[model samples]
Target: MTGRATPRSGALFERAQSVTPGGVNSPVRAFSAVGGTPRFIRSARGAWLTDVDGHEYVDLICSWGPMLLGHAHPEVLEAINEAVARGTSYGTPTEPEVLLAEEIVARTPVEKVRFVSSGTEATMSAIRLARGFTGRDVVIKFAGCYHGHVDALLASAGSGLATLAVPGTPGVPASAAGETIVLPYNDRAAVTAAFAEHGDRIACLITEATPGNMGVVPPEPGFNGFLAQTCRDHGALFISDEVMTGFRATREGGWGLDGAVEGWTPDLMTFGKVMGGGFPAAAFGGRADVMGRLAPEGPVYQAGTLSGNPIATTAGLATLRLATPEVYAALSATADTIIGAVVDALTAAGVPHAVQRAGTMFSVFFRDGAVSDFAGASTQDTAAFAAFFHAMLDAGVYLPPSAFESWFVSAAHDERAVATVLDALPIAAQAAAKASA
Candidate 1:
């Protein structure tokens, strides 16, 4: 398949560069790593994006994992339309917020949830609440696990930071960065040591529940459970940052893969992406005791004018209501088909690759062996990935532009969408092999 010319996207990008930094709101969308004109989307429906250039591609990005049922899902649209008719935002409380919070509580381990406008706020507020509840200052975070661009968490974040090959970002005060201890992911020894040295001063340890930021580096078996136990021992709160994985990876999110089975839960948890149903809603929640420390209740003090916006909450609630066991089953089945084909295609093309998965989320790392941590994930041949990425784009499959991001699939990804991706894989795999050679 030959992609339609992106003349309009090229023109828009040129215009945008004069106004917006790097011509994009998010750095990763610049396609800096992938080396191509980023497609400006015109609209999206079930499993496809129609770009400004009039090219239609199977959407594997899924709006960075928020489109659980898929873009413009009918029920979600109806909910938003009804909500807009009632009113957009009110400084006062709304019914949708309460209903949405209750839906989250029913599915996950969180007992009480506080709404936020973005994943960053969810994580940032959760950390503050943890410190307030514990009376400690230090926090632990895993390298390559991006909670968001919250100043402190950006110290060694993955996602855009990794794509740009930036080390700890500048502008974050040395003092603020000093408060966080960054440890290699999946390394229990590093975690134990950090807690041992900073136990009394440690307020919390935050991690991506399955870590989709650094290309889906799944926690080693029992790793999350161990972190929970170690934090409990040290009197630190364990904050699971599921901003990317929540409700997308599974019906219960990443916790379903481990915590649900182990009968343990994090002291606090952050959620975003799928919970918002393609809108800008996110949340942080956990034990009622820890959450009680937030303002209006106790005194940690975090507020947002847009917190629990009626439209966003209505969309989120509608999405959650539709994300049944059948939705998850479809996602897993679609993922299995695509992942298996990708492996076979790469192997046939003589390209060394490793496909890692966290529940239904997965990524194709351009290297051999298991990528269990940031160090391992970092070794991927990004040049080869770039070549593969462009080839797939030309073939009408939209993948995440960065190798350090997960490929998202939605319940709307039917066999037709899966076939579009499968048809592109062998050719893209060959392109990767040629680039390496």
Candidate 2:
């Protein structure tokens, strides 16, 4: 499999390198951590990707968690097609944006949602609103939480940063990074301690509702509730970043798994991924009063030219409309089957491993024991994962190229797709077992 040909992808890589940095737009897409030619996808539909080289693979990446219904869902395509015929971006108010916002408000705890072009913008604007509303300068974020490349939030992000083994990227200014306090994920004492000292000056504390970047590290029971209470006690905002987990993880996102059960809600929440239906749309929302701080209302001042592009809004609205209870049930069942198979395969190969899950999202860590923090997640055997990754690819299964990221599945991942992954596991697991640290 390692000797298999990838001339088309390889040639494209060389051509791209001459133009783009690292031959990819996103750092992880370069496959630097996994050591392989990144497959340039020619087309994707219903859990399968056809590469430029004409090789087909079951797509477990799901476009990094956005393809909830799977690639090229017919209904979603129809909605986008209808939207396109009317207009793409009007740079003015549209009905799709209004309907999308209403749909979001109905599903989650948000009262008013402001649309954005990407997850980065959603989080960035939420952070600014937190600062402006509270009149504070400092923000606290958990280590290993990747809330996009927003300057202040990138202080100790995971995902691409973890894959590349970089402590933090170099371009962020000292002053920008300095304002952010990085805390360990799932550590209550650290949360208490950080708030104890900086309670008065902290604007907000943002965290992934259920982190998937440094593997799928779910919050410890009562951890999110604790954070909310602490922020409330200090008059600071609690901003939950659900860009990766929203709609894809569950109907109500990560909040449904914990916040709903705990009867707690974040002051502000960010969303993307499945909500966009594979298009570039995201949002931030919370209590109407808190959101009222935005420009056209109070004074926070956030705007985007293509913020609520008609086409993107239509796709998101249609996706959310179709995300029924049955869809969520299928997602859970699919995750259960795949995750169980992964554990069985790794165990059969005598490979020490642990699987972490958050609702429908999950990841495999190449080590033995429960991982609750980034330091623990960092100890995964990259060599073992790289070996397994390539083996799975050879067998026509495309996993997220990094062990630090979650392997996404969709409603489109029918029994056939699951069987494809199951059949490849033993071979990949054996490959992983042979690799040494």
Candidate 2 Cα errors over 4 Å, as ranges:
1-3, 156-167
Write down the lDDT that model 1 would get: 0.89
Alpha-carbon TM-score of each model against the true structure: 0.97, 0.97
**Model 2, range 109-164, lDDT digits (tens) per residue?**
99999999999999999999999999998888888899999988878543321111
Q: List the pairs of residues colliding in candidate 1.
A: none
lDDT (CA) for every model shown? Answer: 0.89, 0.90
Instruction: Give per-residue lDDT, candidate 1, residue 217.
Output: 88
Q: Model 2 reaches what TM-score against the true structure?
A: 0.97
Clashes of 1: 0
